[model samples]
Target: MQTQCGGCKQGGARCCCRCGCHSTAASGGGARLCSLSIPSGRSRGGGGATEICRSPREGTRKAGRQAGRMATRMFEGKDHARVYQKYRFTPQEALQKAVFSYLDRKAGAFGLALDVGCGSGQGTLLLASRFQKVVGTDVSPAQVEEAQQAPHPDNVSFLACPAEELPVADGSVDVLTSFTAAHWFDIPRFMREAERVLAPSGCLVLTTNTLDMRLHFRDRDQELTRIFQEFRDLLTPYMSDKVRLVVGDYEEIFEAVPFPSKERITDIVDKVPMSVAELVGYVQSFSMFQAFLKDRPEEAQAQVQRLQERVLEAMGEASPEARLEFWNRQVCILASRGPVPDHDPRS
Candidate 1:
């Protein structure tokens, strides 16, 4: 379905950021929109002709200060990137299926794919076999280096570059994606660049898994889950305000996409199997947790220890090697530059 908007005259009727500025998080996942911020009502656009009410906010690099900070590059150094690589598991088949379904293409059918903010290239490699050539770009040099060093198909390459300043030629990318990283971007610039780089029939995907993650085992799911949440809660103070974009399910980022054809799917669920220790490692991989460790080393170490101890006790496991389940609810935004590829399901 197509919706048209993005027009602003009187300094742009842009009710933009009107959402982020007013909407509060509901207990069950949704925004309680301020009466003045009519989501379905026509507002003005600051950059385009007509503004659709679906998306939340955006502006250019020259105006990065408008968004406060232009976003600083984090996850530096080989040690940190390697920790990210080892603990941060990529979303598997389910995510791919959602993208393919949106693109209306079979696996391995697309010509080129670009994964922006691709940390460690895990998701970039996931696209390699599917596309004839795949390039992963990240702001972090260490991340790019790690991705380059990973075992990957000959079609894939990695480089360090900011998302707003893509090195790609215009209209050259068939599919563009940012996984779990758009929140940290200068949204307006990145969105503009996404439109510039995509083929007319290309699509854009931005996905981030919500932190409402769950822990599971045989029968003691509730207690185990509590242990995980409590552990995560302790790390909350270290989380950046930028993470609010994710907590809001990328509505703000989605607002930036210029495409008239776009959809947000908040129900994509990804399940990963892991050992209890690995689950803890995944949390350790969190940027917030890393920050916690930096600011409060002894306390951070104690928290990790406490988490392992509590989780193990709850599971009646003697060691951290016991099997565990990691489940996440992912938020995905799929938008086409124009028309999606002509595709037949049975083909």
Candidate 2:
């Protein structure tokens, strides 16, 4: 299972897994011919080494570019962070129950849990009830500050960190969870970080609710659903490429997980009752919606007003007190470092 360069014996450093060739030389050469024996009929000449032509300066530049890209944050500004905190829903009880049930079956320490990309500590607080300690990390300093301000248990703390580079020790985390946030991460790099921080047999739970949502009303379910779809379509242009991964139900993310014992559960629907105004606020909480507001304030405001007016008209009430059901379909990807010997059969 280990991947390393033959010359440097360093994993994930210029090693070609297929040919077992080390692109960089271990003897301080700018480029070197791979010293390993080449198989016949391979890309390299028979019993001869193919020179790797990358210079040290070129490698440094490539590393710098990657670091810069990793530092880039999608959601910014204090105003947007405040909007998120105001409108985003807390972790559903059903989802929390499912996560705890899965973790209970695994034979490992439950002392520490890491919640990556935890916005405003909504999901992080849920972990505090189960684990002895919970640390939430996000790339946005504004979001981290907001999370810190929220009233949470003594065991819960918030930090500003990227998914690829966590401020944690190797194999020290008992459970790692990301709620509706993995889509915004660099999947491959984040997976590696998960591998590094997770203990043996530790669980990695990643979940996200899909954007293909629906709304239900008494005898007006069809009309409400249509209106919601229209609203979703209108916001489509504002969605980033990462959002497409959530739309795909995390299929690409599941594949990126390094664990062999991994499973994906999709279409776990939850019905939540809310008023028309609350639903409008939920839509406004979306990162893309905020981005749209920044890019086209007048157009975004008009669209929001139009959607709100249509919903209120359909409900046959000027008051926002009419209760409607919001059905959210969530996808969960569960993985562990090793096979659980006594996993719950029902889970």
Candidate 3:
């Protein structure tokens, strides 16, 4: 059975709901003010097959200070990259199936798939399974390195580049995708790049899972939920302004897609059964959690430990696994250049 909130009654069945969430004003507009066009003399695919384009170093001392003034920043450093690779969960199969189904129906070619902001190659490798070639790009060179180190097919490659300055030829990409990473991007610039690189009948798909997760135990669901919510509330102050796009369930993001025939599918819930330790590790992977660690390391450790202890106590001995249902409420924005022709008329 399915609930109004998109939760499933079965063990691992995913579901959805149609709730109207409020959208907030766009942030990060003045943070990195730069022209949308590709810089003059920079040809498409100018970067090598696996190039790492390091952002130019700050020239003057004051330039360094100005760079630090940006409101949003990419996740960097070796520690953060390691934590992300270790703790981040894989993309749900249901979500992948949904994405591929849409592409198969509408996209005219599977020539090239570009996954912007692809951290550690999770979603990039998924695209590789279906597309002829896949390229994953991230602003953080560390993240790109981690992605490159991960095992993947030969057709998959990693590049260090910002979303706005994609090193791809115009009208060359058949599928452009961003998974849980677009909120950190300069939306207008990224959208412009997407429009420039995507082929005439290519497709652009952006997806993100919401933060409102639910935990379920046989008899202590409420208690577990309360514990998780309180922990989330503590991390809210450390979160960046860009997080508003995700909290609104991508309502604002959907509107930003520069296409007339776009679709937004929200409330796609996925339930995964995991141990209490795994659940705690999952929480530790959050960007805000990393921020909290930076600001108050001792307090963050204490709170996370307390959360784990509480979860273990509530789960009882018989059932060591708890249902970690991500009300992943994924907002999948899908848009194609135009209608796809059917070679097989019957199909």
Candidate 4:
């Protein structure tokens, strides 16, 4: 006999509090935000899960803050990066919102949209709708395979390749972009590849979201704030020296690449709602989480469970069906790469 999974039966299967695995569902019809809900049990294929009872009131601001603090303290090494990559393995649903979020800001016609580090082609499919062609590539073979299976326009394709060596010919792409993963990249080499593949009038778009909760809560929510402060402290070490270099000033770094474009930079502040379980799922997708699990299995497993409880506890009267709003800052750097320089033979 198969066990009935509470999460799968209770509307959505992404929230398995028992297993610390979460699912993300995108709103259909191209909504700008992706909504997440917490389910009760582990996902066991089909609908197999066991339900357990805890106070729906367990989800409180104070608990979530504690979970966030522990999470921050846990993910501080290379192991967490591995966990971060796995987060992309779950669903491509977020791609539509993420891609549309950028394209809606772009002006003029674009021929091709290239997504670097396009794990599983979520963004690739979204871009396909707006441009003549879309190409998504990632360094992981499993991700490439998953991306290949996504429904896409004839003009959209997925490939497995490192960011430093994209397969496309020089100047063949019209728009090159990345979402959230640029910080993990070899900044100089990735920029060089972007410069090489983009057409004379092509554009390079890069954006990343910094998770901030202080913007989401009132002063009465001190517990939530403490949790995030801990999370931030935990994540500070492995942010990659390269990513740190780009912080505070997108201009200085863009110029370092000599992208040769009139640049337009913008900052978008958005409120994202997530349950405590969903928050764990989000962090599980980060590199820090991956690194933590790889190098410290016992610690990682314990931490994941602790985080789940804390998140649920912090929900603070928010309906299990309700949402938790967290603030984020997305920085977009759009640099236009003009025509290539004319090469002249030595006199």
Candidate 5:
């Protein structure tokens, strides 16, 4: 399933970190998201004197003050760009964590694997160790360049390509996987292409985590539903009629695409206990939040305050431990090629 709502505009549920946000301990043999406390001495790098990885509240007042002053002067335009690029790698980090967790459990299932949009080679590293042959592909030359430099066994390689048009020949890959990057893909075309490339019985694994995005003064879960509805509306323009049919249901995925003899969908929520500060960092990472502030700064700022206060109230009542939850779903679609032919039926 694809969740495109970034967490900024919506604060509480199913936002960018909305769904991808709340991570919990691993159950059902899959990995879960957890908070890694920033060491005391660790510097909170640029981005307006904000605390590193804490709730937005800790720095919001100061940040708001700074943002107000800087908003007038366009402070450090180039530096902001640099920081954005550097920290924008969170999604990839999350993807790598998921891939490795999968490898830790099912590495022996396939001798060859394909990682689509294998940015920075993080996922490829794990695939290379498990499969005798691994091919990583992406659309960005810069990403591909970085990926090429990453160390891999002789069996692993990286390439640049779009999802609709993969370079690999037909019926060759033993296992096919896409990380959190699949939402950007043209699902129908990618599925057709995936089916074409997989050797009979190969599995196509696709996953994208949506953070929890909440509306101001709305029930936490209610905000999630609103954000999802808004996201659905946003995607309507981008999706083809064929792809549109599959929204909010797994059955649509199977019906529109041919492959997939068997399929299973699992929701893996990473629930981390958090303070107000950590929640804000998670919120700012969202594209919608960035855009919301860009288009409607006054309104966005107000929403930010409400979310921070709501979280603080929760934290006060929370256990001695500050908890943050990063929730995500891992959807695995397994399909078989030719039927049992030579000997298996009787054996």
Candidate 6:
């Protein structure tokens, strides 16, 4: 039997949560800010999830002071940073809507939009057309510098800072987001910074694509998918446990969100098309893959090359010319600073 999304019972089976993990970033380690109740069980297939639980929160004031104090060498190397800037997929239009649709309901000015963990600034630049000013902040100076070097409007800027701390003044940011990178954060501590920076009724959106990804080719979808899955499985051991937060759809992160007016949207799917070489570039941008390379450089290089060769073999084609569709499921967690509004959260 296929299970539905616990959030909406809309589609797909849900994945089970093994995340009994706890963090000291907040008080009362497992508390739920259940403005939106979560289903009792795990999500499966393309299932949606409605979750609730408990986790403590850090001091917002303290979070602000810690900003600019920690700039880790995250995504530091020149080649890695360049690949991250070039290969990382931008947040698709649907994901952006998941954020903006909620923000439209908000009551304050939409002057400043801050993107935490804004690696390479793809998502950050998307905000420029809407917000008066946009800032993308990351913990890696290298990533920040790459974002700066990119051609962006004057209204968009970049910074090197950690998620747990932000250098901005209190109640300054109108909309805050962390795309595909919140899993690497001390979420409870980061939530404190989220609370610190957002203006009253401001929106905070945290989003990431789940691991149930698929690679599709015109007539060879299933085979290409198997190959991709094989590649992912090989890299699994290299992935940090931090990725579990994403697999769990940020349930723990939601639990820790200091706000009471929070909800989630699940099963947002996006399909990006790329050539075999380009797909390899995207995979190479994975920090996990980078870790694998660090541990066994020759083996790592050999593995990806093998993956490329196998894919071409499967395609029965030359030149790696086959363009394939890369698909992913997205989950977005949205929280409002002050009160829950009267309109439909889904609306």
| Per-prediction TM-score | 0.77, 0.78, 0.77, 0.62, 0.49, 0.77
lDDT of each: 0.69, 0.71, 0.67, 0.50, 0.45, 0.69
Ranking by TM-score: 2, 1, 3, 6, 4, 5
Q: After superposition, which runs of candidate 5 have C-alpha atoms over 4 Å from their true positions? A: 1-109, 119-128, 141-157, 210-250, 266-279, 290-310, 317-323, 338-347
lDDT of 6 by residue, 192-233 (tens): 788777877678888988988888877887998899899989
Q: Which scores better on lDDT, 5 or 6?
A: 6
lDDT of 1 by residue, 30-123 (tens): 1111111112212234332222322212222222232234455677657788988888887677887887777665222366688988899878
Give lDDT tens digits, candidate 2, residues 1-347: 12234444433344431221222334442222111212122222234433232333343344334435784466557887887787778768667666777777863666678898887778888887776667777776567667767677766766555778775656767789999999988888899999988877689999998986888888888898899899878888889888889989999999999999878888678888898888888898887888789899999989988888899888787888778889898999888787766664333
Model 6: how far is 112 from its true place, Å? 0.2
The prediction achieving the highest lDDT against the true structure is: 2
**Model 4 per-residue lDDT tens digits across residues 67-149:** 23321222223333343433333223343354444444432245557787766665556676676656675555445445554
lDDT of 3 by residue, 9-66 (tens): 2233221110100000022111111111221233355542221122122112222243
Give me the displacement of residue 54 in model 3, in angstroms.
9.8
Rank candidates by lDDT, best first.
Answer: 2, 6, 1, 3, 4, 5
lDDT of 1 at 268: 85
RMSD of each: 14.8, 13.5, 14.0, 17.4, 18.3, 16.4
Candidate 1 runs further than 4 Å off: 1-70, 105-109, 341-347
* Candidate 3 segments whose C-alpha is farther than 4 A from its true place: 1-71, 317-327, 342-347
Q: Specify the poorest-scoring 10-residue window by lDDT in model 1.
A: 29-38
> Global lDDT for candidate 4?
0.50
**TM-score of structure candidate 3:** 0.77
Query: Which parts of model 4 are misplaced by more than 4 Å?
Result: 1-108, 150-154, 211-222, 237-239, 246-252, 264-266, 317-322, 339-347
Score residue 221 of candidate 6 by CA lDDT: 79
